[model samples]
Target: MSNLIPTGRTDIEWRNESTQKPPKAAVYPAEANADKILKAAYEHTATVWTGDFHNAKQVLAAMKKRVKRPSEKKRAGGGDAVAERSRNIQTAFHAHRMKQAQQSRILNMLAVEIGAGFTLDIPRAPDVKAALADVYGKPNDAPFLLPLNQLLGFIGAHEWHKKGVEIPALGGRIHVPFGVFSPLRGEYLDLIAAALAGSKFQTAFDIGTGSGIIAALLAKHGVPKITATDTNPRAVACACANFCRLDLDNIVIEKTDLFPAGCADLIVCNPPWLPAKPSSAVEAALYDPESRMLEGFLNGAAAHLNDGGEVWLVMSDLAEHLHLREQDFLPQCFQTASLEIAEVLQTRPKHAKAADENDPLAFARGREVTSLYRLKKAV
Candidate 1:
């Protein structure tokens, strides 16, 4: 058992004996312990959790089953009480985090089995050791170990990279690279296309441009100039790659948290629809938790809009229908931000999850609604 403590924040560098490739490893947090590391490895491997990788994944998914279990049991039946339900949800969230943290710790404690080749003893190790090596910039013979949680994260990210979703709305489909968000919802894309049909803006800014889909759409619609900005390095890389592929290299992709230091005739944002704590880094698309992105866009939008410029706010009232958020509070947020609603375009979600009767929030889905609001900064 070799314990290598990182000196500081600097990455750990290693050389592969066979492939002569160099790779850098991330430093683990100081407080990680052996038990936490072991738990993470067990979670990743199907043997301890089960023997099948898919089964292990299903077990992990079971953690979220309660989040949508309310609709299955009739209102007056032997279902959990409201208070119990809330507590269960809270527990689910905490357990999810605990599992993730343990996984990260395990990856940090991982030790490499070095010989003529390399292998990892971590539980349920991914079959894509070659792919992982490529990403880590190492050869198959490089002897290195990463935290169990981090290794799982890398493998999950690799899968997502391999099976990229294509957006039909954007003529040139955007690919989701590792650690970048994939556009999983299609209803919102339809809403955006319809909303942009009658609008005329030569220059536009796409705030929080995850995969740069909006920017690509603007460019496709004959908009000569579009600026796409995101704070995440993964998002920036994904967006740039999509733009380059579409030959919209003119669409500048910036690494800004929000708006750039200039104004635009049109600014558009599709902030996460729900305001709740995210279960993981990947859940940013589903939950903003703090409404930080939504608020930031609204508060800074007025300053970035040109004369008669419009800020397109695409969102859903699903949270409101589920009682998680107040429907009327959205307009109030606009008012507080000093903006007025110019127009509202509504659409229904096409995802099967929306109409899933078994979902805990299905009551809302039965009558759920989503909309796109065009707002203008008050003069």
Candidate 2:
């Protein structure tokens, strides 16, 4: 039997000690299986073993393509194409959920096996046990089971950590820990760097500092002191780890909802680009339902800025192009917050998704642009 218990704010713990074990981890059942689950998993995780972080993403994309289409052709004699597509989508969703659940159970079982090795003085499972410890922060003996997908994700992130991403603008390679947000977009950083260069302030505040990249960039560019804040525990850990790695511990990393009560000469925020509900916790990068982060930054920025101070807001107009948000509402927001726009620096996205013509939102993405706006609190 499995016992459900609350562990952390974001995760639940499942303790299963019954003789009847949980389901086996789902894998491609056979080499000849049409779904090719094993092949996909191997390819997606190969970079993890090799320390090529970027390539792992490419492999995952390829795997997505394999399971994309429905088995029945559109021309098959089975109802309208739209209905068939919907049915196929529902089927796919169920299968994906089941696979994820089974995989989680399997990994839980593996964790138990690793724990037993340590408990019974078994000698052969050191590597697997050690890897699990490295990622989970505990030996296999712990009565908690992590989701298999999450375990795989951590393993992949560890590989990326080993490789490390370089930020030329900051003149440093930032070591992002497993499960931290990596700075994949350079154009945004360029805009931020430019904004920092143009600003006259010496002190700055970074809101929602995921990996503290922006704060680090500001510090690297000669900002004397910076207060970087994040609400997520993982992000806070990530920021601290990155700051220590870059030797920027002088830039204080704090766990706060947004601002930590003080005024700075400059305040900077890079909120999520779209105002949509995130599909998963990891998708926070692309979604900010109701524009919570953006609105909070704007509303509270004035109070946290010194008189004549500036707030630099970096965001993309893709949401507007998608008809998900009003394009003209940003200026209105500033007006409501009693702030005035000082200057706007814009840049085009360089990611392949922006240029891929086959993308569902290609038409909108091609015309999309990211901007860095410097706003000042009214006198």
Model 1, 27-143: lDDT tens digits are: 333333334434434443211221334443444344334232355366313335333434444444344455554433333333333222335443554565654643443454534
Per-model CA lDDT versus the true structure: 0.63, 0.64
302: Cα error in model 1, Å: 0.6
Top candidate on TM-score is: 2
lDDT by residue (1-379, candidate 2, tens digit) is 4433332222323433222243333221112221343343333211111213233334444444454545433332243543433344434333444554444333333222113432312232124443344344545444344333344555667667767788889888776665456788889899988776755677899998988899999988888889999877778887887788888866998898889878999899988887766534445766787898899889999999888788889989887766667868898899989999888999999989897654434556778899999899765
Clash tally, candidates in order: 13, 0
Consecutive 10-residue window with the lowest summed lDDT within model 2: 44-53
- TM-scores for all predictions: 0.69, 0.71
For model 1, the stretches where C-alpha displacement exceeds 4 angstroms are 1-160
